[model samples]
Target: MIVVTTPTGQIGSQLVHRLLDQDKEVRVIVRDASRLEDTVRERVETVEGSHDEPGVLDEALPGAEALFWLVPPSRQAPSVREYYLGFARVGAAAVARHGVGHVVGVSSAGHGWPTPAGVLSAAFAMDAELGASGAAYRALSMPFYMENLLGQLDAIRGPGAFHLTCAGDLPLASIATRDIAGVAADLLTDLSWTGQRNLPVFGPDRLTPDGMAEVISQELGRPVTYRRMSMDDYASLLRSRGAGDQQVKDMTEAFAAQDHGIYDADWATAEPTSTDFRTWCREVLRPAADA
Candidate 1:
């Protein structure tokens, strides 16, 4: 049996469906089982609990062959690292205690880089904790999530314009959550060999935010413009969205780092996914915009 945490999240939800499609016996750990739809809740054994609680894991972890573990983000935490580390420490203990052999963890790009990754520091910590756990682990290093762009859909549909903080045609290696899920499903189904592994999954092509706007424009059959927001504007928008000073600073630093090619590192292997920005816009974003 494979147990998955955060099964209601974008990547985790897709992973669950892919596993169920392949007839893999799966268990999902969700804080509230009622949050899941009727069909998904029915198909899998639901361990209605949070990962932070050891008692919950004690009941859920045992007898699982492989586990897909992820620490979901929370705004209420003092810091993302503190929130994530608490869960990671407990999860590592659970993995060792339960004897679940293989573990696949969702990590961000540039996990082991020496320099500070700002917002991505939590993922680096996850890689370290998961590495030391002695469980067979594969850290999937995902790029900028395509879903992140969904936030701009309102502007795209209303004013038909998108604004970004990035400058100078920054190359983006974005990946769809569905692609990540498919890969995770493959890993759980085929656990051939693993000690500590990393997969760099990229989309079919890389494009700048302006280039992305053009692609979306073409796909939507409408005129769309892209403008770069100043640092001040960016910070103001972030603050409006409920980000404090530290969160705003972290986001700004990560964007600067991405521009400087800090996050562009070699992975053990590259799994190029099929979903390009144009196709994603056509199939997913466009419909959402029209709605």
Candidate 2:
């Protein structure tokens, strides 16, 4: 049996369907089953409640071979660091108790970089918590998601511009959550690997906020521009949108870290994913815009 956490999230929900397609016995830990698709609800075993709770995981991990874990964000979290580590510590103990062997988790790039900011730091800390356990782990390391742009579609429609905290011209590594989930599903089903590692799920090409605006203009056939906001200004903007103090701090620091240097080295991998910026803007963003 394979267990999934945050099963209703953007990545986990898709991963659940992919695993079902492969004929694996799938179980999910979720807060609300109703958020799941009608088809998904009928197929998988549901353990209702938060996955980070010890009681919930104790029940979910027994007889399970592999696990897909993700720590869902909460604006109301008291401490982002403690929140990430707290879930990891609980899950690690449960993994040991239940004898689950393999773990494929969601994380980001820059694992070894110094003083990683915000979610970047918390993600690395979470990986360490999972690694301390006996299970073999693979952290699916990602960069900025392409889907982040969808949140700004309204701003683009209204003012012909969208904002980011990073510099307009500096290249930003990015990947689509679909590609991350696709590779993760392949790994979870096999369960043949042992030992811990990181998969750099960077997409086909690196593009800056300005470069992305160019692609959006070309794809949507409308003039759009990139608006670079300072870290303080961005934090203020997030607070205005209802983000709490911890969330504002985490997000602002994460963006500042990216502007400095998101990844430590160049990724010269062979045959990276083909879902380039233009393709995403054309396929995903265009449909969202029309809606």
The lDDT per prediction is 0.81, 0.86
What is the alpha-carbon lDDT of model 2 when measured against the actual structure?
Answer: 0.86
**For model 2, how does the per-residue alpha-carbon lDDT over 141-167 read when each residue is reduced to its tens digit?**
888899998889998877889888888
Top candidate on lDDT is: 2
Cα deviation in Å at residue 16, candidate 2? 1.1
For candidate 2, the per-residue lDDT at 287 reads 90
Highest TM-score model number: 2
Model 1 stretches with alpha carbons more than 4 Å out: 267-269
User: Per-residue alpha-carbon lDDT of model 1 for 228-282, expressed as tens digits?
Assistant: 8887888898789898887777777776666666546742246578898888888
Model 1 lDDT at residue 169: 80
